[model samples]
Target: MNRSETFMEPENFVTFELVVHGFLVLIIGTIGIIGNIFCLLVLCRPSMRNSINCLFIGLAFIDILLILSAFVMFSLPAFQVYVERKFMWNVIDVYQYTTPFVYPIAMITQTASVYMTLTIALERYLVVCLPLKSRSICTYGRAKRCVFTVIIFSTSYNVTRFLEYSFETFVIDEERGITVTFLQSTDLRENPLYISIYINWLYMVFMCLVPFSVLFLVNLRIAWGIRQARMERSRISSSQRNEESLAIMLMVIVFIFIACNTPAMISNIMETFQIQAVKLTQISNLLIVFNSSISIFIYTTFSRKFRRILLQVWHRKRPEDDVLFRWKAEGGPNLTGNRSTRTISARRGARVLTATTSLEFQREISS
Candidate 1:
């Protein structure tokens, strides 16, 4: 990889590339809006759903915010030119001060989302594997506290890097009217203005290693919890239903985590092993884009209800301005002629269906 590798764009780079990239961005942004908003709706519904989904819903919302915030860079005219260039590192993209904000914002948002996933995993692990004591430790209040803790810790993890970016460690050069920033491996040799290896190690550990370690252990425990649930509930408890719900959600997050971070891991490992490969770095960088892009798919897979609600919300006209909730009333009887149906709200345990709510409610209540 040469520092002077000039990347030339096609003759109609701005026109064709912008059209394609803009459409792609709009589609992703639309899905992000719908998915995150729908997750928020599901979280706000009632005690049961909220209790289980508060962390996940928050995660969904953060992922949504990450995608939305990325539009700032993606929408900028520089993005068109940056992507057109062959080398991302050589391109003059975001402003220097903006790097302090944008880079950490992206990293922290990602870290926070994964932290929430870890919390969700641990919660499921305890509930499934140690049901007796889980009740004592994993209450809704405790879960809420954990959510706050993740936000705090992960946000702090990225903030440290943001501070480092401002210390004049990086050298900015103007090449062919393009400002390029080089993130040198180190700047603390004979002449040291501010950069140090200790600081670089700090960046590596927090920005990469610790978060990776946490995600691995958390996802592993989630798998263990899933297996334990299947074994323990095989006889009569019918724990598959519960395990399926939690597993799908956690698995989606874990998969996305892997997709987003695997490239970076490979590059980092190559460096650790003293192997040289620029292709690996390029591949990993591409994965970062995929990591950000695949979030909508994750939502669709983990949450069937989220998918349904998102479709409805997207198709519905003036949904944001509307107030009244109109649901399909799942499991409602398909009535025959000569019988009109009217649904009315009622207090708990009260009859709302022709004075004849079916036995399903009874079965649930008894169970």
Candidate 2:
């Protein structure tokens, strides 16, 4: 078999690619963009402020860029064909011009997204398994630094991707007054040394193997920590329980990342072996798009606090309502329970005072 020979895909595969990469990506990407915007709004609120949520905000922003770039690179091309078939406006030329830039951005953001998830998992692992050290290690300053580092590394790693393609323009039909511009692969992209060292070995190790192995082990440790805490549930504090909840939520996110990313990882490995896996590659792209789009749903489903803040934002409710809601959620005084009204009011007042003090303490620590 010729290692460089193109594989001929079956007709069904074409249809599958068109539907999955075209319409499905369009729908999912649209929803993902809007959902991530909402996620940003919710995460940015004062009540949601924390190191983890700060990382989440960064992740959401990266996902937005990833989805948008995928839409332009993959979805718009599909639409371009559809427009040609229907003889519609040639707006698809937009993709032709934007792809060179968007392609590298997408690659950078996807790389950043993977590492950011890993960072979140590692942070959670520290918080859950080594609570004492996490106080100093997982501060907001460190989280921001981690994010900035990931962005820098991702961009630096993908700098070659930006240089891999060059754009050119030509007249296709002089009589019809038609011209087209498209990306052409540069020699660097075709160089065997570059391909072997950077594309195959470096990419597989850094993007695939390292992250997958670390996340798997860290998540297992986190699960063990949560289980140990649960066994001593009666002795655990409310804050500990909240930590477990957050850890579980992050575990779900990591699991989804592994699942969605496994196909792409497999495709990459197969390609490294000179195997033709075009269909798998297409499917992997769709899954990656889906992965980038699903975080908001995960956050809302796993976090009551997130949902409460979302509702508060939507309803424009008072800040006191949030404090009261949190107090109640933490097993505060029950206004309608068997307790007498005076006793309930007194307990409620005390709880409110405690909550206020805790909030102030958190503010001081955060500052």
Candidate 3:
């Protein structure tokens, strides 16, 4: 759907794809909005307002916008196609109203989000392993600078994409029957210029393997540092345990990010090799929505704070599963029904205790 070959395949275009994407846009948009809003709340808290947390929170907001943009354009159109509702013309109108630019704003958003995530990982490694240096350097002022830099640099990527690709408008007249239009796509769609012979190598070197190597090394060093501290101390302080949990959580987050995005990246590389006709390009577009959607689960589902905020959002009104999760996270010392469990409450109480001294007393009583 995004290539520049100037070939038309209406037969290959499945209208049902529009329906699937419509659902996708709504679902992903909801996830992005809910998750990012929670992240923003957490980041705004004075205690949580640090460089690493700021980075992740900023990423969530970006994802929200990206998902929204996708919803406005791809998903809605796909859904319209499925319903045969002719609603895409309205979506195109919304697209014009909402989009900052006419060309691939989504591509830009995802690219920026990826680099921002890498920055977040780097900041996390620093904060966990080099607490002193991180304290000195990772201030609000420094974090703001990093965020600004990421925004500016990521925006520049769109320049190349727009310069390389453009769009066309088509009209279908009654006398002429049907008229078609062609649109040129982004520069990332092209083979590397100076290194065309080594397209895969260049992409792997600059975009994939190099960054992966650095992130893996940083993660390893942080893991090793945490282990050494544990061995030397023999007894872990609450602070030490906090550091370990954070490091582990952050590490898993980065690993999951890489895992979720790897298949799509490989698919992009394959595009440069075998220009196989786009079988399910719309499906791929929907996958992009899925890609952005899963970040919510990756960041929020595993953490106590995320659950707390989410529960707070639904305060005193929830279904069975949410009630279960809330019970599990809150140390419901006196859960009323099937939600009750000593082990579950103990674990949640420990979390609450770690977070608050008042809760610490509560946990002891519950125990």
Candidate 4:
């Protein structure tokens, strides 16, 4: 095919792939990478560390990997048309050399991210809908284990992706000394049984069907649980209210996941039926990138604790400030002790009261 007929053909000097998956992804992915990094930093803090946040930390880290891989696989190639021939040649050389590994890494991270999000949903369901059992079931150690297990499963499931492509180097024009390398598919990648079972059926089942179904159901239960909790707002403790808020935040995340992932799932179904959906697939890829990029915003908007901790990290505030902020925001200290401890508690409360009154006075003056 001529350049004009090629899929990467430019429209007004910019290709569709370049515009959608390349330049757009470059901008969004950069923001996502930075946002996920901030998420990691905020989630790691003492105040934010918990079972749910641990899973969030894993999700954020996987997102960073996925975004970086997307940049290399999709975004970098978009810039080839804008660079000098020599630079483009080097870019192609680097891309070719790294594609085999990058492709598998991207797949692995993407799958891990999907499962990680699922894990978060399941964890939230247990906590919010099955609160009585969640006390025993959900713990920091268990969350870490779940994260590790998902990583292992995602990696093991995608192991064949590593063998799917083999790198080949050859001279395109010996006279002009132009040499290039490209990834060539292996026999295993072409096998009908492998393609049908692993690539088509299993991918649809595990990556799309199962996660989406479970997320939908779990989110419904979570939403219902939050509704029930709101009815008894007067009886619920501040901590319980915080947990409910976290659950609400997670529901929003799952909602976004479903919305962004629906196109990709539909595209997969079309491809499974031997239908050509190139445009749909491109749109799906864009949405997937977008989905991976927006979790930080959801957390910021829906979880007050996340916002507070994020601000604390950004401002380099003391840990005590976090406690005081929580106490102030929640309307009291979430303290637990026996009657024998009232003396010491009252002394600490007096100090806290004095400090809080002084801070409130300063705030009133500033306003």
- Who wins the TM-score comparison? 2
Question: Candidate 1 — number of clashing residue pairs?
Answer: 0
**Error at 137, model 2, angstroms:** 1.3
* CA lDDT for candidate 4: 0.76
Residue-wise C-alpha lDDT for candidate 3, range 129-149, written one tens digit per residue: 787998798766787788888
Any residue pairs clashing in model 1, and if so which?
Answer: none
lDDT, candidate 2, equals 0.80
In angstroms, the error of model 1 at 192 is: 7.3
TM-scores of the candidates in the order shown: 0.62, 0.83, 0.67, 0.81
The better-scoring model by TM-score among 2 and 3 is: 2
Encode model 4's per-residue lDDT on 1-367: one tens digit a residue. 0011112444533456667766788888889998999899878866555687788899998999988888877666556644533244443444556677898988899899899999999998998888899989988899999999999999999999899889778999999999977778899989989988988999999999999999999998999989987887768865676677778778888888899889888888887788866656766777778888988888888766677667878998975775566445644433576665766666666677677655433221001
Query: Please, what is the whole-model Cα lDDT of each candidate in the order they appear?
Result: 0.53, 0.80, 0.59, 0.76
Q: Write the candidate numbers in order of decreasing lDDT.
A: 2, 4, 3, 1
Residue-level lDDT for 203 in candidate 3: 48
Rank by TM-score, descending? 2, 4, 3, 1
Model 1: ten consecutive residues of lowest lDDT = 358-367
